[model samples]
Target: MPPKSAHHALQLEHERERDATQGFEPKGTFGFIRYLEHGFPSSLVRWHYHDEYELHLTLESSGKVFVGDYIGQFAPGHLVLTGPRVPHNWVSIDTPEEGVELRDMVIQFAHAPLETLAGVIPEVKSILPLLHRALHGIEFFNISAQAHERFMRIRDSTGLPRFIEFLTLLGELARSSDYQLLSTIPMQSTDDDAALARISSAINFIVQNYASQFSMKELAQQLDMPERMFSRFFRSATGNSFTDFVNRLRVNKACELLMETERYVTNICYDAGFNNVANFNRRFLELKGMTPKAFRQQAQGRFGA
Candidate 1:
């Protein structure tokens, strides 16, 4: 469990989700940047989405970062870009073997840099599609050895020069050939402003109840929609049926528990909400291309947990 003070601070941060008055109209030149240096023993979801495009640069860390439909290992020199309303989170479970740390910088920008208003501008139009692709997620490697210095410069500078330089680097990144799209599914329209609210609500439901046994019946009722309509809406919005989507979360959680805990595979399966050990094994193999034991062995070889 988190320490008392940290627990309260985290709760306060989580409560921000309850305020649904804010609209999803993309705002520009309004990104907030911050530095994060996390040591260990952290198990908080903070699984919220926003209108801002998030750029998180992992300085020196090895953990799993779940971005939209993607879940994989996150290591040093990794920079991930996620677009608006793509629910993501980083969970840090302490290692029982020696020392480990997770450190990174997160810059959340208002909407994407390319807006419909900028469609008329020839230059802006060139980069619009790339930015649109980010709605799913993007991951890049900081191959430039001087990246630390460049990051420091961006962090310390204050004013238009800094902002311009920042945009320039991002432009270079958007145009670069060395990035991977994390989610293959094209982002769907939540329709309009109300779509954002619905997406937010769905994410809230997932994060708050991932550990428990949840059914679409409850969610459909809560959203005040017919079961069929809610099911269709969810599949269209997330690119996965409700069952598959929740299974992804379960498998992701199982991966973390497998590596971080000495708990048996059967126990881990039960804890992650798997109905049976056999099913868990099958799904784990399907998604990870390995059985739970094999995955744990691999992670231990690399992370030595």
Candidate 2:
């Protein structure tokens, strides 16, 4: 028999081979977005990427989600928008013996047509920023009820009506503030060039210094803006309060540590910039719906570990 290390290496190689680029071409489709649904354990449930933005909604089962290099948990009502060619997969761990009948509902559309339309159609221009953010991956919260309804409408209709409903869905997602960027680095900006520059600077600083102690007041002073005003501006641009943003960065860092290292939870808490283990556990549970240890255990399933 092969050694354990050799077996694991072979397993990883096999999984990488499964991570092929899925090709899609719209055939007889009325509009840009194509709607698709499939059951758990189907051919669609693989680590893959394609040249279209995918708005994916998980309707059943709980699992670990992999987007780019981010690994996290996912459950019902989990809605994530992934940009073109950003690798992603959801491996359901809680499937029943017979498997789920319908686990995922998805809509995909290309970027070029949307960009072209935005050049002429003022209203459609609003979705540009959302598309840009999806380059990392955006997991929206609290809109699953509405999203499910819209997906059903898109699936049931044909031609222009379906296209209109799809637009409505895009508009809703673009406007929503309750979301988190999942992979790479979380970045947010506004239309104002000046504001975008300032926010970009602040985001860069935060991303670099997240492991150290810092304050919004200190950052505000550095920017020569009043604390209260800076606080509001930061929220407007990033969709998260300054403190919440820092905490999320720390939590995501902790997730990476838990997934990649064998270190103790206490050490990881401080390493991820949390001053205390209790607060680390609380924040992890609040943002992830699971404790740090639970998250680590579930993340292992992402690799078939």
Candidate 3:
């Protein structure tokens, strides 16, 4: 058998591989709340989802923020609230500085604790609507410099002080009117068990096998339902047709690859499960409002690639 160090290294490698393939992971400390500070070009900067609700403040950077299917610009003083299990990432524009540190301040907490507290203190429920809006992710705009200072204070404090500061921040955000919903579609959650199960299965299958050619008939059969019935149910549950959902996933993957790699557009289209270039270009333009080449160029210009 290998040494203990070798075994630990192997375990770390396996965990990383799992994270690369399966995007969902638990983040931060396993407590009521967790605080994290990160610099640019860190390993934590990636496209991944977590079960915690994240209150993120940009400290020193300007770049694009991707939440679910929405992508937009972000800069210093940009604040966002992301709900549980929403895929999100922030890519900073490249800078000339060699060793910049601490570009973001992040706070994450579980929903259950807040919900429990709200049950006891009704006043806390005022933020419930804001939490609901975070299901699609919320970007707070025109945030004042004082609000940014509060975020820094939250990061600097500990224990109950940190918790109180966080609650105060939430109260202010809940009352503020300057914000935008980033995602067009909300992450579906339903009380109907059957509908939830069916939709979850369908989404998981697509995420796991997005590179393959999707057949609606085959998917319906796999779900043990007729094609027409499955189509209706999918639309009702997701607010998107089966074809549109698949196309959006493919387009999203294409966008990631376009920004992250130097692959040819045609090759990226095929790799993203599109059969041909023309359809890919058409769908890309329709979804992203730009050609793949133009998108890449724009991203390159922003990142100084």
Best by TM-score: 1
Residue 266's lDDT within candidate 3 is: 91
lDDT (CA) per prediction? 0.65, 0.79, 0.76
- Can you give the lDDT of residue 204 in candidate 1? 56
TM-score against native, each model: 0.63, 0.58, 0.58
Better of 2 and 3 by lDDT: 2
Per-residue lDDT over 62-158 for candidate 3, one digit per residue giving the tens place of the 0 to 100 score: 8878776566667788889998877678888864466348787777778988999999999999988989999899998777576777777776676
The stretch of ten residues in a row with the least summed lDDT in candidate 3 is 6-15
The sequence of per-residue lDDT tens digits that candidate 2 reaches over residues 60-92 is: 999888675456789999999998766577889
Tens-digit per-residue lDDT, 1-305, candidate 1: 11123222212123244222222112332344322233344443454455667677666546677677676777667777788766666654434455445455555455434465366666656556667888778887654434455556666665665666566656777677877887657553343546555645765566546778778877887877788998998888778888887788789889989987999999999888887899999989987899999999998998856
Report the alpha-carbon TM-score of model 1 versus the true structure.
0.63
